[model samples]
Each structure stands twice: as structure tokens, then as C-alpha cells.
Target: MKSTLKDPEPLLETQWPADPVKPRKAGWGGLKRRLAPYGFVSPTVILMFVLMLVPIVMVIGYSFMNNVIMTKHPKFVGLDNYVTILTDSVFHTALANTLAFTFASVAAHIVLGLLFAMLLNSPLLGTRFKALFRAVYVLPWLFTVAIIAVLWRLLLDPNGVINFLLMNAGIIDSKIEWLSSPGTALFAVTFINIWAGYPFYMVSILAGLQGIPKDLYEAATVDGANNFQRFLHVTLPQLKPIIISMAMLDLIWTSQQFALIWMTTGGGPINVTEMLSTYTYKLAFSQYQFSLASAAAVVILLLSMILAFFYIRHQKARD
Candidate 1:
């Protein structure tokens, strides 16, 4: 009889209506959904504009003004800086050296890299030694440019290891001043750069070589192709794209190479090894001609863009 009627509190709780769900503000929700992606991307965009674009724009503007260290207020100079750079024999020499250094280093990189890669990829080599060989070859590249310059400077010194070995080997009767001689300075720097840079090409080309389908080589062999023939007909074609891309990248990197040249040679022996990058630094900091240096930098920027554009066009054409 006591439990026949439910308790009043329990009955009241059961009879109370569930709370209603509030309707979403459809406009605000849709707006947020649309903006979420851009909100995430905004930080990167702002940073690039501030850091990269702003500096480039400022440099370009400064190139047209007399923004030297001596001037409190920069005056507009128009094309005077450009005219001076164009007419300067030193600048011309720098430009030529830059071109020579870039081309020679890249060429050597390709040859040495390809040779090492091919040797490493050969089926004749033991599989156990392949990784070790790659690591050993790549050790030079792991060192900083400054370290490499210092090491090479010592090695190329008149009485250093290189001369000691050469004299002991009966190759030379005298110690050669490799960095102090204009004739040998550029070549020595270029050689050191090539040694440091070839590993990049080796790794790149090795990757490309490994990516080539085994089936292609098998099919070529089935058609009575020898190793050289198969490599000529199949390997070279497959590697062309990778080679072009890597060469272009190397060209850009080599053109901008400064620290090694700066530390090792200082463009010495009458500016024989002065590249555009080193020349620009010498002008800006050492000579304190900021406006002219800006002009030189602009020229370098334009040349780099032009080269990149042509490379892209060539790649697209091949595609």
C-alpha cells in the first residue's frame, strides 16, 4: 500500500520536459568554416611578405638612391650605379670569374658524381660496402663551407700536405703557392668547391638511378643489349630530367658560393677569384658603398631569375 503511489519528487522529475537545443547561427558558422583555411595560412603569407618581399623591395629602392655609409640622407641617383658597375673593369672581371667558377664546378660535379654513383651502383660491388662508401664520399659535404675553406687553405699551402706529397712523389721540385698565384688560385678554389659539391650530385644521381625500373634493363638485355648499350639507350634518357634539375640547382648554388672563396682566397692575387657574390660583399662592407652594392645585388638577382626562367622553360619543353 505504501509503494502503490510513486514518491511526489520522483514523479515530478519524470514529468519535467527535456531542455530544448538552441538553434545554431547558420551565417556565423558558415563564415567560420570558409575562413578557417585562410586563417591557418595567413601567418606564413604574412611572414614571407615581411621577410622576403620587403627586403627585396627595399634593396631595389636603395639601388636607385645614394644610400652610401657617408650619406645621412639617401639621394636619388638613377642609373649612375649601374653605369659605374658596367664600366668598371673589376666588376667585369668578377662577373667573368663568377661564370667560370659556376660552370667549371658544376661540370666537375657532374662528372665526378656520375663516376662515383656508377661505381657504387655496380652489381660487382659488395652490397655490404655500398652504404659505407656513400657515407665516406659524402663526408666532405657535411663540413661547413668555412671549415672546408680552412682545411683546403692548409692543404694547398706552399709547405702543406699537398706539396709534401707532390715533392716526395717526384712530381714537383718546389713548393707551389696555390692560393697566392693568380693562375692557380681560381683553379684551386674551383677544385675544392667541386670536391665539396660532388657528393650532392652523387646522391641525387644515385636516387635517380635506383628509381629506374629493373624491367627496362631486363627488356633491353633480352633484346641483345650490352651494358654500355643499355646504359646509353635506357639509362641516359631516364636520367635526363633528374640531371637537368640537379644541374640547374647546382648552378644556382655555385653562383652564390661566397664563404669558401672569401675565406680561402679573399679574391686575392689581383681579384682573380672574385665572384659576383664576393665582389658584392667587398663593396658593401669593406668599401662601404651600400648603394653600388645594392645595384650589383640587383644585377645578380636579375641574372639568377633569367637563368631559372630559362631552365624552367627547358624542363617544360622536355616534358
Candidate 2:
């Protein structure tokens, strides 16, 4: 075996000569790649700073001063404006009304939205019927807030179609001044808001429902669970996270609602429908109390921030 053939040349020793490999230099390409994401988002960052953060900062400064915008030389009173707003009776009334309006709207939105979503997701409905129902239910959402306000004002007029219908149905004997009456203004506006907002929840919930696995429902059925029981144990549990998120968002939005109330009731009839937003608006524009208005606005912002913090914490926990 030793004499059979000359040993093959050692592979390692027979390597061909070549140029030495050079390391890549740090260059514009690497830097560009690193900066690409930030470049893409820079416009949004700039806009938020200018539109949101700057105004917020200016408002906060005004909140601590006296006679801002009204006077050439505004004095820094250091919380006097805040103290004045906090002690005002009208502010208390506005806060209470805001809470009630928000609570009712959000609760009703959840219930109605969930019901409509379940109906839309049902197996019993034909595709055409489901489509028709979806279109009808989402009509309110398609209208702008201004349009909604105008439409509702007409509909809720004492001599309008709603009153006629109610009278015909024997629900009431006399026409109710819904938006004009202090007793009914808050209710009317809250109802209008609820109608406008439910479709958002319905669409979101329907998407969530569609994403749920059929196997879970099937397994529940096999275990002798009925519709109600299955909904209680499976559907509710699956939807818990989405419901919480929507509710929190609704609370923030409903708390800040102003346009509809302003257009419909103008926070009138003894301030029954006055909200934080309307209150601040009147103080700044009508009363020319810019400092006090800024203070009220700052309070609202703090409340919104607290709600946002909870929402973010919830999202992190979910992740």
C-alpha cells in the first residue's frame, strides 16, 4: 500500500497565494441604515411636538399666570387660577355632568355594540342580511359630528318626528323639550353620542369575534354548554381585553365631548349639559378669563393622562 502511489500533495500546504482580506470601514451606508427608521418617523415627531406638546406647555404656563392673553403683561400668580377654578360652583356642576354623560354613553355603547356584533357574527343570518344590517348600524358613524348634532337637534325638537312618534305610541301625552329642557338636555346629548359611537365598538368587536377559534366553541358545546353558558365562560373571557381597551378609550373621548353638546344644548337650560370642555370654552371666549380656562384645561389634561397611563399599563401587562 505504501508503494501504490505517491502521496497526494498536502492540501493545506498547497494553498494558492491571494490578496489579504480588508475589514469594512464604517461609512455613510451603515449610518444611513441606522438612521432610516428615525428619518421615517421624524415628521410625525416634529408635528406632535409643535401641535400637541407646545400648546400643552403654553397652556400649563398660562394656568399658573393671571389674565393671560387678555393682558399685555400677564402676572405669574402660581396656582391662583387653578385655585379659583377648583373652587367655582359651575366647575363642580360641569364635572358632575361630564361624569354622568361619559358613564351612560360608555355603558350603553358597550351593551349595544356587543349585541349588534354578536348578531352580525351569528350563523343564522344570511350574508346579504348581515351586510344590510352592518350598513344600517354604521350609518351614524359615517356622519361628521357637526352633521350628527344638527340631525339630532332637528329630531329631538319638541314638534319633531320623535315626539310625534312617542305621542302616537302612547309613550307620552305631551311633547318633551328634549334639548331645550334642563331635565332632558343631558340625556338627549348622551343618547346622541351613544348612537354615534356604538358602531366603532361593533366593528372592533366583530373583528375580534371572527378571530376567535371555532374549536373552543365546539369543545364547549361538546361539554354540554348552552349558548348563554358558552358566552359567559368562553366569549366573555376571550373579549375581556378588547372590552377593557375600548371602554378606557371611550371614557377619554366621551369625557372630552363638546361639539355635540354645544351645538344641541349650548350647555344651556341652567347648565344641565355643561361639560369640562364647554366650561373651559365659555371661560376663555365668553368671559375672557383665559387664565381660568387654561387652568380648567390643565385639569382635564391631567385626568386624560391618568387614564392614558392606565391604558398603557394594561397594554404592557397584556403583552
Candidate 3:
């Protein structure tokens, strides 16, 4: 027989000592470690379930019904409501407008937020002024959306400061109705949202930016990396998680925006600025098209779910 190496006397046998797992604690010791995190989080879970989960479940149940207003009778119509509302012209209009508003707002939020955060992060800016500017930026968000909408509506009105200034400058002979016209109403609402909403994204992103080590940038500099290159490599990688989270949060907020539209345009002169939220309200309350409105709610809920799903998947994939 060819003297094959004896496999080093079977290293598996040499190395296979007892693969001992530590003993499990009998009770409280194990429980304390496992329960500590849940104990800390339990209040939030209870609150969310009571406030958010219950409401969402109720909404979903109502979405499948044609409810009588006076009697509170919910007749299950299955998918008919969905099909009918989905095919409705006004629903289509609201869908398009809502999407346009959401996309524009979210895009502007991420881009402008990043830009503002970058500026705020700079050593070129004075910290004192930065604090002042940040405070001012946050003021719009501090106000209720309804209040903000009313403020902007007045500012954008014919006799509002905007038109007053323009007319004073002889910019136009006629006063334009910023919230009244079909062309300008939706776009005007979008601008207000962008202005009010961007600060939150900026602040959150700035916080994320702060978490990144200054050493990373220093190392990049040592490697002859330029500002742009360093940002593209180091800053962006650090910001990816925050950006995804911020984008999802913003999408949900922008999609559900109701008070602004209600206060500013009331869904417009001819259903021009009517987003899905306003449209759903009009259907349910105004027209008593309960089933149809429920269907619209379902659509909104589904869209939000899709956004949240993608956000979570993106986060998981990153991990």
C-alpha cells in the first residue's frame, strides 16, 4: 500500500473536544436579559397599538363596506367599490395630482435637505448664525399644517403681500389668484410643503452627518481625495441609511397632507389640486359616496404600505 499521509492522525479527532454550550439559567437571570429591551419598549408598543394600529384596522374594515351615514350600517360590497372608484375620472385626477405632489415634495426634501445639511456642516458658516437659521427653518414645521396653510394662502392671495409687492413693482396690472387658478394651485401647495417640510429632513440628515467620524475625511485627504471625491465615498455611504429612512418618513407625511390642501385651495376651483386625501374626503362626506371613498382610502393605504415596505427592504439590504 502506498504510505498515504496518516491525515495527521485525524486532526478532527484531536480537535473535537466537547462543544459545550453554557448552561441556561433556570429563570429570572435569563428572563431579565431577554425582557430588558421589551420592558423599555413596551410603552411605545402599547401606545402605537392603541393609537395607530387600532385606527388602521378600523379603516381597513370600513374600506370594504358601503356604510349608511344615518344608520351606521356597513354593507360589504367586496371589490366593487374598489373597481368603481379606480375607474372614476375624478379619482384618476386626484391620483395623478397626489403622485405629482408626493414625488416633487420627497425629491425636493432629500436634495434640498442634503444641500442645507452640507452648508450647515461647513466651517465657512458661523455657528451662531447657523443656530439662528436652523431655528427659523424649523419654525414653519412648528406651526400646525392648517395654520401654515392659512398663512401661505394669505401670503399668496391677490391682496396678499406677494401680489401687493409685485403690483407695487408694476410687475403685473392684474392680481393673480395663487390658490384659485388650476395652473397655479397645485404647484403653489407643493412649494409651501417643500418650504415647511425640508427643515425636518435637513436636521435629521445633519444629525446623521455628525455621526460620521472626521477621521474618515482626514484619511481620504491623506489619500489625495478631493472634496467631491471624499463626499462621494465617505459622506454618502454614511448618509445612505438616514436618507432611506428620511425619504420614507417624508413620503408618508407628504402623501397624507390634508390640512394644507383643505385650508389653502379646498381641492381647487375645478378639482385641480385635489389629492387623494381630499378626494376621499369629498367622496365620503360631501357626496356620501362612502364605498367609493373607502376604496380611495384603501388605495392611499396601499401606496403608503408600498413605500414603507421598500424603505424597510432597503434598510435590511444595507444591513
Candidate 4:
């Protein structure tokens, strides 16, 4: 056994150095991932900047200058344009008319829309009847502004069907100049706007009604609440947010309405139906007072922004 044994070799000791840590260099792939969101949104941002922001800035600059867009060298006039617009009697009249039109239209729209929506939502009505009424009520919303304007103009003409019917019914002694008379032009336009806009309110309210919880109504019924009581307490409470939001939006839109009035009354009849929109247009294109128009536009923008602020706050509060 001893003669067959062989000697073992000793093990060698080795010390290996740690590999150097490499700093990560971001590749094109990593960079692309980081920038992909911005790249996707850049077009929209650029488009808004060019179309909206640029125009707004230009208008603001024009508001502070004299003879803007009409003269070779426009002079800075500070707040003179604003002062002139604010003090102008015509501007005051336009403002008053705009307020009257907007408030009346929004109020009537809500009242009529709520009434129609309630009728449509009634369980007593058959589905076929509901569908028919819904279609008829919403027909106005499907027409373009131009079409609506033209249709209303024809209908409100002095010798038109409306006058004929009114006269035959003994409601009027003579044909009324609905759009031509100063006293009636504002009323006529307001009525037309209300007719055209109420369908939007009706649709929105109908949706809101459908979404209301049945349990609330059931509970109200269990509490011995009458139909009117339930509607006042339950239905109105549920639709409050929707109604408020719609009213504000309608106010903004109705305040800016130009096409309908322009096509119907042309802000005529001694400017009785003149709105801020028409007033600004006249200052710019008709009177060649670009600075005054810009100032007026800025005022309108400010008013709209105020409305938007309230709207956004309400939405956030609702959320």
C-alpha cells in the first residue's frame, strides 16, 4: 500500500480584482421612451400656440395701440381704447342687450327643457309617443345656425304665417314687424335663440334624470311626499349640478351669439338688438376702429374667462 501511494500537489492562492463599475449611458431607446409623451403632445401644443395664443397676443397688443392694422405706424395709446369703449353709449347699449338676451334665453331654455324632459320621462306616456315627441323636440337642435336663422326670419316676417295666424286669432290688430321694430327685435331674437337652444338642455336633463337613483324617489314616495314635493325636493336636487353647468355654458354661448342675430336682425332697428359681438364687428370692419374693436374683444375675453373660471370651479366642486 505505501509503495503504490503518490504525493499530492499544494493548492495555489489567487487574488482577483473587482470589475470596474460602468456608468450607464442612456441610449436612443431610453431617450425616446422619456420623450415619447412630449412628442405626442407637441403638435397640439404648437397648434394652439400658433392659432390661439398668437392671435390673442396680437389682439391684446392691438388693443393698446392706435390705428392698428390700418396705419403704417401704429402708436401706443395705453388704456385710451379701453376708456373709449367703456364710456361709449353704444357699447353700454350693446352690453345691456347682450345681458338681457343671454339671461332670458338661458332661463327660458331651462324651463322649457325641464318641462319637455319631464314629459318625455313620464311613465304614463307610451314608448311610441315618447319617441315621437323626443324627435320633434330635438329637431331644432339638428339644424345649423344658418338654417335656424333663415327659418326664424321667414317665420317672424310682418306678413308671414305667424302674423297671419295671430291676426286671424285676434291676438294682434295688425301685422307686427317682429325683427324690424326696435321694441320687438330683441324679443324676437331671444325667442328664436331659446327655441334653438332648449333642445340641448332637454337632452342633458333627460340623461341626468335617467341616471338618478330609483332608491331616492322610492324613499321620497315612502315619506308621503306628493308628486310636486318629490319633484321639487328629489328631482331638482339631483339635476342641480347639471342645470347649473348647462346654464353657465349657455350663458357663455348665448352671449357670444352673432350669426343668428346677424342673419335675423343684423343688429338693426336702431341697434336695439345689438350685442357685444355685433358691436365689436362694426368697430373693426365697418367703422375701421381696429383698436376699439380689439379692446372690446379683450373685454369679452375677460368676461368669458370669468365665466369659465366659475364653471371650472363648479366642476371641481362636483367631483
Better of 1 and 4 by TM-score: 4
Each candidate structure's TM-score, on Cα atoms with residue i matched to residue i, is 0.89, 0.92, 0.80, 0.92
Residue-level lDDT of model 4, residues 97-192, one tens digit each, is 999999999999999999999999999999999999999999999999999998988888988999999999999999899999988999999999
- Sorted by lDDT, highest first, which candidate order results? 4, 2, 1, 3
Tell me which residue pairs clash in candidate 1: none
RMSD of each: 7.1, 3.3, 10.3, 3.5
- Candidate 2, 161-219: lDDT as tens digits: 99999999999999999998888888889899999999999999999999899999999
Consecutive 10-residue window with the lowest summed lDDT within model 4 = 1-10
Per-model CA lDDT versus the true structure: 0.91, 0.94, 0.86, 0.95
**Model 4 regions more than 4 Å off:** 1-24
What shift in Å separates residue 299 of candidate 2 from its native position after superposition?
Answer: 0.4
Encode model 1's per-residue lDDT on 257-315: one tens digit a residue: 98889899998889999999999999999999999999999999999998899788878
Could you give candidate 3's per-residue lDDT for residues 244-287 as a string of tens digits?
A: 88888788888898988888889987999988999999988998
Candidate ranking (TM-score, best to worst):
4, 2, 1, 3
Winner of 2 and 4 under lDDT: 4
Give the poorly placed runs of model 3, Cα more than 4 Å off. Answer: 1-67, 70-76, 168-173
List the candidate 2 regions with Cα displacement exceeding 4 Å: 1-24
